[model samples]
Target: MQSKNQLVELPLFAEKQVTLVLKREDLLHPFISGNKYRKLKYNLLEANNSGHGTILTFGGAFSNHIEATSFAAKEKGFKSIGIIRGEELVDSWHKNTTLLKAHEDGMKFKFVSRDDYRRKEDSDFLADLTKEFGEFYLVPEGGTNTLAIKGCEEIITEDDKQFNFICSSVGTGGTVSGLINSSFPHQEVLGFSSLKGDFLKKDIDKLTNNIRWNLISDYHFGGYAKISQELIHFINEFKKYTNIPLDPIYTGKMMFGLFDMVRRDTFAKGTKVLAIHTGGLQGIAGMNSVLKKKKLPLLDI
Candidate 1:
């Protein structure tokens, strides 16, 4: 399903004379929304065509991938198994909103320690999972695989050709890689990573040889799944003004970076920028719970 692109209006836009539009990929589904839908679409078909009866993937407490994969697997008539990263969550997984939603959608969980989770790519670990789950199609953590990139490529269409720049929040690099591959020659693709470091550039390079893309390494705001009071305030204020809700992990950081760049005149005057709102809104409730426990201000969505 193609989502409508809404133009974002801000005082800064007029003052800077730059046009900003938000590609509402978040509206793709109430549950399996945004880049998650794009990433999983073809992967699901591939799994079914390959005669797989179960889908196995990896994630953490509030991983959007795990939740989206669960619903997608159920809708496709395939069973799903989520290899959760934290072993301590095994007892309380049902209490966590994200995991609970996945469970409600018929996902089974295999909780592992953080140390053990790091070995997910090892042959022996994967072999053990295959033996236990009985021959399942494996989706890598964060849902970035060859098939996933193929699906994400469809996010940008001919209609998006008018824009000079295409921006998105980079996680596993699949969505941004797809954007890079599909971008027009005149359009530059900028990916704002939601994690710390410049390592994602190498992974995206492995996927596509395109030289039209650049990775922005300074906007992570810590690392994956890490949030701050400032980010929470920005997200809330942004929603209040634009009616567009941004999750703390990805889109929020992306928009923050994009706007900051605009203030610094990163783009020339009259430049049209299209920012992809890859959805992770489902995890907001789970994140709010964490904030509540820590006595931090909750997201005002």
Candidate 2:
């Protein structure tokens, strides 16, 4: 699945003293792109290895993992089950095209109450889900399994680029953890979070066993799935200048924070950096709607 894409570097930071290369995992899969592919590849192989007919996992209403996993499962002749969080009914089940496509791809979605999803870590959760679904392959929320990390770790092993710093978004920390574990002992990794507060940091740290790294606290942009006009504009100008589509939900915040840090001279001269494009491009379908709702200038025309 990974052989279909290529790696391209983005020169950043005033084109002076620092440059960031985007490990373009975004182009890996058209239907379900970016780090989602690497994270699920091994798990899918394991599912096929185990002879399981279906894959079960959890995510939110607009979750990229859920969408990707759904298409991937159906493409490989396995079914999918997405355990969605939140109890409220969305205005329409057809609101999200990606989720709708997943349904067409043979995904069996089970929406749980907000309270039940919060206890997702407990053994009872797995027991209940297993009992409900029978003997199917289980992929945890965000697809942060050991197998996924092992696959995500390949981002670092790709080539011999000795970057001083490596950064990625911290959704489930699978990508960050894998990149850190795959790097040289002295190289540093800075995971920028789109989720607010210290809760996400603690979760990523706990999931990390043998690797130690850094985390920046100032990013988030009002928490996960939250966005600002400034960010939307940034996404627009970013596309205009680079011609690369950045999904606003995750990678946009990372790029925003990264640009801010770069302007501040975060790294010393000649410091090379790398950032992972953990794709969320499906979210772009709503970009035009959002910009128009805010009366922002259009870039598509």
Candidate 3:
């Protein structure tokens, strides 16, 4: 579905003489929202056509991919299995809102240690999972693959060509890669990495040859799934001002970085920027839970 681009009427944009519009992909669906929906569309179709009865994927405890995949599989009549990282959550999974919702949507979880989870792509790991769970369609972590990229390419329609810059939060690199492949030559695509390192550049390069893209690595906060009080305060304030809720992980960091860059005069005056709201709003509750434990400020829902 084509999402509406909502104009963000922030004072910062007015002061900078730049236009910032958010492509509200977050409103795509309650569960399978934003990039997750784009990433999973064709992958689910392939699984159904291939006669697969079960869908298996990997993710962390609060992964949007894991939650979205579970709901989509249930809706499409496929059994879902989540190969979750963090064996420590084997007993505590029910406490996590994301995992609990996925479980309610008919997902069975197989928790593994962080090290074993790192071997998720190894042939031996797949063989072992095959022996246990029987044959299933394997959707890579973050639900990114060739089909996912193909789906994500559809995110940028003819209407998006008016923007001078296209911005998105980078997790598995598939979403940004698709944006790069489909973006206008004159438009620069910027990826705000949710992860700490520059490793995603190589992953994205493998998917697209377009040189109109750059990965910004400065706003990860700490690393994947990491957050701080400043970020929480910004997210809450952003929602208050714009009535748009942002998750602590991907989209919040991307928005924060985008606004900061604007404050630093990174974009020329009269530039039109479209920041994609790749939904991970479902993770906010879980993130708030963590924040409470740390005695930090909470993200307003």
Candidate 4:
């Protein structure tokens, strides 16, 4: 039996001859959704098969990865540990927050200095973490691994609809890289960088063996977790047309860039595009929460 929900087909807006179709992978699960689920599937299974009692990973305060891994590991009967970035905020121990929810549900966490987390490239640094966790299976930050990429590739194959172009927002580049690897011939895949200083093409190349693709860097607004009024206005406008709300973190920037590119005539006449909605939509909860306080007009989607 399938454990998750059905894929959501979110509509797109096209001007001139180009058409867009969004594969809403966000709605795949309620507790922990999107590509996070796909990536963790094999990782958790392997951890269990190896007889590891604990799963260790890393992420930030709003990390979909840490949240997903925590719940998934819980369901799969493994202990979860998140090496969080920075000091825990005051009142942050409560599980109402997603990260804290992980902790509440038996996911253990340890806070580390940002400077120390930045040293992840150092083997000595990882050795320290591994020693602290004690024989845990380590999932990289963002749940990225070769096996994870393979699982995401299956998502690309699920849709047979022919598309001239594909795009998605990139955090660690796992989903976008997998989409490129599994895309049908003649389909060009593009990734929108969600963070500043992120070299997604380079990062994907490191995880992907021989998967060719494109990375569009112009759409991030102001890197990860940043937005502007223009973005808000566009998000509202997009929902007016498509009845789907794009969270500012990922899909919102993607649609913004896609539309801008269309206006700039980057896409030729009659082009068809497929944008994967790799969801981290809990960002919307925080977003809409803030908007409610400001009493801004909400998009009715």
Off by over 4 Å in 4: 1-14, 88-96, 209-212, 287-301
Model 3 sits at a Cα RMSD from the real structure of 0.7
Query: Can you write out model 3's per-residue Cα lDDT over 146-190, one digit (the tens) per residue?
Result: 999999999998998899999999999999998998899889999
Estimated TM-score per prediction?
A: 0.98, 0.89, 0.99, 0.87
Write model 4 residue lDDT over 58-88, tens digit each, in one string.
Answer: 8877777888889898888888888888775
**Backbone clashes in model 1, listed as residue pairs:** none
lDDT of 2 by residue, 1-301 (tens): 4432223344655465686777777887887788788889899999998899989998887778888999999888897888888656344556666668778888987878988988777888888888888878988888997898888888775463577778888887888888778877668888988788877777777666655578776878888877777887887888787777788878889989988888787778778777888888876765555566878654332
Which stretches of model 3 miss by more than 4 angstroms?
none
Question: Which regions of candidate 1 fall more than 4 Å away from where they truly are?
Answer: none
Candidate 3 Cα deviation (angstroms), residue 37: 0.3
The C-alpha RMSD of each candidate to the native structure, in angstroms, is 0.8, 2.8, 0.7, 3.3
lDDT of each: 0.94, 0.79, 0.94, 0.76
lDDT (tens digit, per residue) of candidate 1 on 79-164:
99999999899788879889999999999999999998999999999999988889999999999999999999999999999999
Clashes of 3: 0
